[model samples]
Target: MTEARSNIAPVLRYAAMRRIRSFEERVGELFLRGQSAGSMLHLSIGEEAVVGMTDAMAPGDTFTTHHRGHGVFLARGADPARMMAEIAGKESGYCRGKGGSMHIADRALGHLGANAIVGGGIPHVVGAGLTYRNRRSGQISVAFFGDGAMSQGILYESMNMAALWHLPVIFCCINNQYGMGTRVDRSAGKLGFGGRAEAFGLIAAHAEGQEVEAVHHAARDLVAAARDGRPGFLEIDAYRFYGHARMDKSPYRSPEEEAEGRARDPLTTARARLAAEGLADAADLDRIDAAAAVEMDAALEADVAAAPPGLPTMFQDVYAPGTPAPRPQADRLRAVLSEAPR
Candidate 1:
């Protein structure tokens, strides 16, 4: 625990983790209050350290994340207000509220997007890697997937291509132990995920995801290799304290198992270590947490008051303007508009 403090500034790492935890907790509260756009919500509550590795990434490096990605995006400096608005389905959101919880994307922040499908975003980083290489951008692309995605054939195919072509890509598998309700052991035949990437001729590493410094060191080395045109794989061992989705209670997991997972929460561990080492007092950490709460609460209020996208704008981003709409659809839209009181 003290080792991480030495590897990186404890204040910086702890602050980021606390902010992510606070942001996700507030989102959950807003969702339960029926302020969010969609009923489906996923949180990266116990896996803050998994995203803490991004501290090692350069600004030019891009990343694609899985559904439970608010922490990852937040760590990369995505505006909390806009992210909240997106979750609330406000027109002011990143994708004009269209992407919602599962598909938030901000190209300017180097966040390609968060994919809903288990393995949907894996290949995207490969494509970005190809683009970076072709442009000689000296940038790397990272793909963050879960243990569940390890079973998906698309992941393997993407890894093979990355290795064969020497693409600057890092395949980061956050092995949170459970994919939905099924434990990883029951799902993946092999416990070691790095071997899967090594089989495809890529440098592979396994690290403790709960320790921020451990993940950061591993990520830094892997990213350096990737920049040199060597693809790599990293499997970070962490656990999701909550169920897969917002409404799920994880009845499949025993009470003892759930308790055990919570005990190892990275936020709690980080705070304890910081306090013990005299790096930061409880008061300092609490102040950061309080500020995060205030920021997120205001964002939630604004998002709830924001307007939803108008029907006329449905196909605006989908297709180029001036393209003729289908006759039947155009007529229906006109009819609906005419019947409105306005």
Candidate 2:
């Protein structure tokens, strides 16, 4: 059960970024073919470095992510097949096909879940940090939220509590310039996101979200501090290649901005770095790309072949054991009428 030997740093980062890019492109194709379950699908195409931070985390560390978190989940070692199954609404999905893309969660990997609600999962990390402290587990909790969530009150509240209790939680904000087509300048005030966290008396770290190594270094430092019973904040200045959701074409963004964002593709940058450092050759990178394609193809095939959840199962996970759900309004009215004198 020995861990596999690691690849050179640049090559490792390139492979990880390639895998995510391939997986997400395939997902976009699936959605186009009407194979996915829900209307909401947020791809993390240009934000692979956020996932690279996974290299810095410990086994016991836990995290929650925003809706656009496929890369993070994959980086944290989630099975590609199960993830595709969840998006396809197959019975084999992580949530029995109930959670879909937005709520994929694997407790074994310490990935609590991805939240679709803006700033919904921020406080959950605080709760996890508090639990770790109480249980003396020495585990840190990380929360990944978008810049759009910066204005949410719950984020501030969570930071306040984490700082006050010296809880082990990290708030990693992916500032992708835009939050659902609205420029960050329009959404958040002039103050930087890290500054806001510092105002709450927590150590804040800032790093470029485009470079995998840079993100890993910063995350390593912040995670170490969190492990020692201190709360921290991280700001990653990145860009989103696509719009907010599947249907959005980013009409709000200018063509110049779009082109500029596209030019800074993280995968391309990582590949170039690997070559410049003589860490890997073109063939090596191609082999990595081929392997990722084969893996994703098999996963998508399994997801397509998997069965859908049964009707009885709909009510099973929704309620507590032996707790009856409320009767339908029509049924209740009929019962009341029958019992009355009329």
Candidate 3:
């Protein structure tokens, strides 16, 4: 592993970390203030490194994420104001406020979207890879999912297709031990999620997701391999500091488990590494944090001031052009007779 260089620019790394943390903190505040209405809100508090490392890869690479994906979006250069507006149901949001915490999409930044369904986005990423391969675009598509997604059949199917076609796809499994309320040992027949990829004939690599530098190295190599028309899998052993969802107290795991995970907070670990290696000083990190705080605060204010979508939008974006509109109950009988009797 390469030591942190003193001259290396930590701007992107610090930005990713601060954005994720700020987003999560804002979500909590929004929920408390009754501005956000959702049954669950999964916060990626300690798992910032996974996406931070990804930010170091190709700029045009595409990524699809699971419900717990604030980190991925921020690392991919998603606009904080837009994301806030979306979560607040404002028209300026990525989905025009239709997609809340679980479904944010920004194609311009190569973020296909984040899906609420556990393994729903895996096949989408494969399709993206296929599109890139067909066009010879040299673009790589990535799928970010939790450990629970490994059990889903779609994950296996997607992996099979990517391997068979040699598409440029990277399967990133953020194995945080617990899937909702169930622990990995209790749910997974095979605890090794990376090994499952190898069974489908895909190159698999495992890394400590808690370490930013380690994830950066692993993701960098996998991305390079994928760009060469080789599909690969990366299993990142990380943990979420909070519950699976906002409402979950995580009774499945004890308090001790949560504490142990918190001790290895990825953001803190990254900062410590930089400082210990003389790559950055305390002053630099404090400045980065302060700047991020200001940015997030301004974003929240903008999101609150934006307008919500109107009622007419409900019928839009639902069907293709020239598609016939549904007939009313009273008109349906007359239309049927006019067509059939004629």
Candidate 4:
């Protein structure tokens, strides 16, 4: 798929944001309809500009994501139908129904994986960056985590290692404010996440996730620096318009707060920006949104109808090739009974 690249042409960026917004909305609907694999869907509805980072990245750059990675993967060229299938736990999904929404990954797309652990995936990019540096490949790696991970010691360690080794890696913090039910301000005493990166001698930038163009520009420069063996950090601060998970209604947050957060909708902001700039008129923007909606609607239907992985294949990918597969628990029980009778 063609990309927005360094400049992030306004029309293409708007279209990509539209697709992510539509796809996320469809995911929410899927959960509501009880078609999702689990009750653990984390939507990236309001944080569409985080996907803009993909626009700055070139082919072969690798990335790892936190739980709310659906938008990023989609922007990086994941098939929406397959993504929905994965979220639905269907056989045709990216991980063959094994990895649902939070864990979906495609190595072919340079996505190492989406990890559920707070800062679990950050270190992997450091290792990848080390490999790239040793090979002089000029390729970079990225670790996409959340503000919650700001408190994780592993993140600091990983950042230090990346800087110390002069590895080409980027630590991208998608700071959507809330960590679970708690607000970020309530947790971290010292803010300015970018300031912490400076202590480690890494280039860092912060951008509002609502501004698609601004995010793309920040990411583009960071990508260039990372390719040149300068590890960097980017904090895309946005607001989470929903709860931590699909099941969470977030009683902790007042209705007014949610309203205020929703008002900062990145898609709405980008659409108006595009129109105001004459990059896309209302009709063109509507067409883009309509196309996205159609694409996701079809994807939803396909995923809803897609078959689940057969029970017999449960352990298919669990072990090394040629390793003895574990017998079904029922079969094991029967064998034990037979031996006892003898």
Candidate 5:
């Protein structure tokens, strides 16, 4: 039992790191290979600690993720095969390939979903918390968003409501230094992201998001408070190694900025911490890496052989049960008629 318990953290950390690295790298390659389609990809490199922190939370606890959510979904135990298939636009994806990288969901795992619209998932997580409270359930809901999302009004509104209602919610802000081309300093008036939560009377904590142990400890404490019916906030000071999206040249940031960010790679930091603390040896970490590589390779191969969804099934899941079919011609005429005003 002691050995099993000791090995769990290292394995989980390695898996989260591996999945994020492999998924992002492969997605980029696939995009360059002309196999991927949709909105530009925002790879979450150098910020694996946030996902590692989520791995320590309760299994039933739910969370809403941002555009850079592949790590979160994997840390929450989402199947890599399906996730890769989804990114590859295969039929076996989480949303039957309809929702790609930014919109993956696994209801059973309590991943409500990841949203492409910045700050879109904030209110949804609040709704989930309200559902838990109304049902008298003990589960906690988490909202994960980037520092740029701090500018949005819905985030503040959600915080106000969560604090007032004493909802079991945790708002995790991954302050990755920039929101697209704009730096945090350029966009947010307050430099400290966590302090922004205090106005709503929510208990907030900030930590070194590049360090897995630090992030895990902070998350565990906040999640404990949340489960006790207190809303909390955590601001993880992390960085992303990639641009906001594939099309972005990141001209706003310099080579020096990228170098500074790369120096604190989360995967390396986590492995070193585990070794220094005697929780795991280098060999154990290597074995985990090897296993992760194998899994990722298999997933990629399967994704390559997969086919896109059929065109006939495009509108299959658009409506609720017994809803009438949408009339395109009538809708177009109604728009013209309404504009003409009789």
Candidate 6:
């Protein structure tokens, strides 16, 4: 992909956003169909524009993502069918049905892993950055977390380390307004979020997800700078179109607030932008969306049809190879009975 947003066609950008939205909608459907592995699925429904940052990321760039990360991973070149299979806990998943929704990762794609903890994944990139700096690899690491991580001491520590060592890293906070029902304005004493990053001596910037092109352009500059040994931080303001999880009804926010937030949907905004600028027409965009829906529909079908790992493989990925595994209770009981009497 291009290292800059302008290098990519406008239709491609809209397609990326539309693809993400479509995949997430399938995720919701997966849950409703009871095929999802767990009830704790975190959807990036309204935060699809974060993929704009992936556009700025060059080959060999590494990143760790937050739990609400399916879209970013997809934009980074994940297979939707396998992704759905993983989330469904099917044997054909990326991790053989182990990582599930919150932990899908593809090392070959430079995704270290997705962390379920709020700020757990933030520091992994700092370590990767240090290695890149030592080897003169010219590669940068990015840590994608949510606004909920802004208060985490680990994030501050990681930022300070990255700045002090001049490590090539970017800590992007996806601020979707609410931190599990507590609004950002209520959770943090500081509002802009980027201001806090600036205090750590890192290059900081902010953008609205409602304008994905704007976010992409902002990221292009910062990503270039980060690759030059200067650390950077970005806080993208997005809205959580649904509750924090599949089961959350988001009772804390009013209908008026949710309506206003949903009105700024980036996917819709990008479609309008493409049409308004003559980069694409309504018919073209409709075809793009129709294709995305068909793609996701097939992915969901694959997920439902895929088989589970089954009991024989229960301990497969849980232990290291060439090491003895603990005996199952039934096996141990059989061994005891055989040795006790004749």
lDDT of 1 at 269: 79
Question: Across residues 1-342, which tens digit of lDDT does each residue of candidate 3 receive?
Answer: 124554564545755787789878887776667666465578888788776457655878888999998888888888888988888777888998788879999988998989999999999989999899999998999999989898899999999999999999999998888788888899987777778889888889888867877787788888888888888999888888888877777877788888998888877877887788777767777787888888888887787778989966755666765796544566788878889954
lDDT of 1 by residue, 1-342 (tens): 233245346578888887888889989998889898877789998888975568878897899999988988999988888999999888899989789989999999999999999999999999999999899899999998899899999999999999989999999888889889999999977789888889999999888766776787788899999999999998888888898888999999998998888887887777787787777777777888888888888877888888899877676766666886545587899989999997
lDDT of 1 at 2: 32
86-202: candidate 5 lDDT, tens digit per residue:
876789888888888888888999999999899999988889889989997889999888898899999999999999998999999988888998988899876986777988988
Q: List the residue pairs that clash in candidate 2.
A: none
lDDT, candidates in the order shown: 0.87, 0.86, 0.82, 0.90, 0.82, 0.90
Candidate 4 to truth, TM: 0.95
Residue runs of model 3 more than 4 Å from their true location after superposition: 1-5, 321-342
Q: Which ten-residue region of model 3 has the weakest summed lDDT? A: 1-10
Please identify model 1 stretches exceeding 4 Å from their true place: 1-8, 322-342
lDDT, residue 245, candidate 1:
86
TM-score for predicted model 3 compared with the true structure? 0.91
Alpha-carbon deviation at 88 in model 6, angstroms: 0.4
- Candidate 2 per-residue lDDT, tens place, 1-342, comes to 012324476576677788888889888877998989977899988888886577788887899999988988888888888999899888998889999999999999999999999899999999999999898898999999889899899999999999999899999998887788898988866857888999999999887877887888888898988888889999888899998888999999888998899787777777777766667766777899999999998888888889999866766756777899655567789989999985
Model 5 segments more than 4 A misplaced: 1-7, 327-342
lDDT of 3 at 286: 79
Q: Which residues of candidate 6, in runs, are more than 4 Å off?
A: 1-8
Clashes of 1: 0
Superposed by TM-score, candidate 3 places the C-alpha of residue 173 at a distance from the truth, in angstroms, of 0.6
